[model samples]
Target: MTSTTQQHPLPLTGRIAVVTGAASGMGAAIAERLAADGASVALLARRTERLDDLALKIKAAGGEAFGVSVDVTDQSSVDRGAEEVRQRLGRVDLVVNAAGVMLGAPVQEARIDDWTKMIDTNLTGALRLAHAFVGDLVKAAAEGRTADLVNISSVGSRGAFPTHGVYSATKAALTQFSEAIRADLSPADVRVSSVEPGMTATELGANLSDEQLELLGSTFAGIPPLAPADIADVVAFVVSRRRELNLSYLVAVPTRQV
Candidate 1:
C-alpha cells in the first residue's frame, strides 16, 4: 500500500476541531472525516436541522460531534459559537474556515449589497474565526501540540473569470491572509495553509443565478469533478501527520479543469 493509504490511526483523537459552514458540502465532509478519525468535532452553520442530522450520523458511527449554529459574518455569533465549543470540548486543535458564499453578478449589474455579502462571508468570516481561535491554537502549540488553521481557498483567487469578479477577490484575499498568518505564526507552531479547490461538485455555486449555474454546468460537463470527499481526504492527510510535518499549501483541482 502507498504510505498514504496505509493504516494510520487518528493523530488528532481527543483533539477538538471546529468547522464552520458545516451544514453541507466540503465543511460537512471534513467534519465527518475528522470525527471518523477520532477527533471531537464542533459543527457550525446557519442551519440547525442539517447540523443535527450530521451530528446524529457521527454519533451513530461512534464518533463525537456537536451541532452549532453561527453566522460567520456576525462577530457575536462567531464568538458565542467558539465559547460553546470551548465549554464542551476544552481545547480546539484544528480550524477549517469553510463558511463562504459566491454570487456571480457581473460588475455592471451586480448590486453593491451582493458584493458586500461575498466580502463578509468569504473574507471576514475566515478572519473572525482566526481572531477568535488563534489564542487557543497558540496555547496548544506551547504544549508541544501542532494545531492547524486550514483556510478553504479557491482557484478563482488567481483569475477574474467573467462574472466572478467579487467572488474571486474574496478568495484571493483569503489566500493572502492564510499565507500571512503562516509567516507570522512560525514561532507559535501554528501551521496555516490554504486548500485551493477548482471545479468541485458542491452547493458552493448554489447562490449563482440559473443562467450562471447553467453556464458553469456546461463548462464542467466533461470533467470528472472533485467531490467534497476528495477535499476532505486531503485535509485528513494534512492533519494526521506528526507535529513537525506541515502541509504548507495544497491545490487539489480536477485534472481536466482547465
Candidate 2:
C-alpha cells in the first residue's frame, strides 16, 4: 500500500502547525503526517524524550518538525510552548488539539481526581491552546493564507458507555466547542473542525483498571480497530482542503465498531 506520506502531495507547504499530545499515539501520527504533507510541525507534550525522538523521525523522512516540552494542563506552559513554536516555525497556520486523557470507572467508584484530570487536559487544555494561538491563526488568514484548528474528539462523544462518563463528556464538549469556534472564526477565514474517531488501537486507555480492560477486551474481542494512521489521514484531508469548503465535522469508526 502506498503510504499517505507518499500518496498525498504537499498541499501545506510553507504552513506551520502545532500538535499537542504529540509524543505518541494519534498525535504523533498526525504530526508526522502533517510534516509529510509539507507543513513544519511542532510536537508538544510532557515527555521531552519522546517528542525529540518523533522529531528526529520526521526529519529523517525529509519533513520538518521540532519538539516542545509542554504540560497541556498548565496555561503558562502552553503559552511558552506556543511562543516557542512561533519563534521556531514563524507562525501557526494550523493547530491540532490532540492532547487528551481517558479514565474509565463506574460513577460510584470514579475518583474525583480522575474526573478533574480529564476535564483539565481534554477540555481546558485544548481551550488554552486555542486561546493562545488565535492571534496567529487570524494573522495567517489575514495574510491570504488558510488557517485551521482541528480538535480530536472520540466516538464516545456520540453516545454513553459504561465507565466512560467523564471521558465522554469531555469529548462531547470539545465537539460543541469546535462548532462554536468555527462559527466565530468564519469571518476571519480561519477554519475549525472536529474529528471523532472510534476504537483505535492506542495507549489512551492503558490506565484502565483490570475490570475496564476486561470489558474493553470482551467488547472489541473479534473486531479490528482503526489504526492511528487512519485517523491522521482524515485529519490531513480536512485541513488540506481548499478554503471554500469548511469540511467541518467527521466521525470515523472501525467498520466493525458498531
Question: TM-score for each prediction?
Answer: 0.95, 0.96
Worst 10 residues of 2 by lDDT: 1-10
Top of the candidates by lDDT = 2
Taking the tens digit of each residue's C-alpha lDDT, what string does model 2 give over 29-103?
A: 999999999999999999999999999999999999989999999999998998899888798989999998999
Per-residue lDDT of candidate 1, residues 1-258 (tens digit)? 655656766667777899998999999999999999999999999999999999999999989998989999999999999999999998798999988888897788968999999999999999999999999999999998779999999999996588889899999999999988899887789899899989888898887889998887787788998999999998888888887878978899999987
Candidate 1: regions farther than 4 A off: 1-9
Q: What local lDDT score does residue 237 receive in model 1, on the 0 to 100 scale?
A: 89
User: Model 1: how far is 30 from its true place, Å?
Assistant: 0.4
| Candidate 2 Cα outliers beyond 4 Å, as residue runs | 1-9
Residue 257 lDDT, candidate 1, scale 0-100: 83
Please give the distance, in angstroms, between residue 166's alpha carbon in candidate 1 and its true position after superposition: 0.6
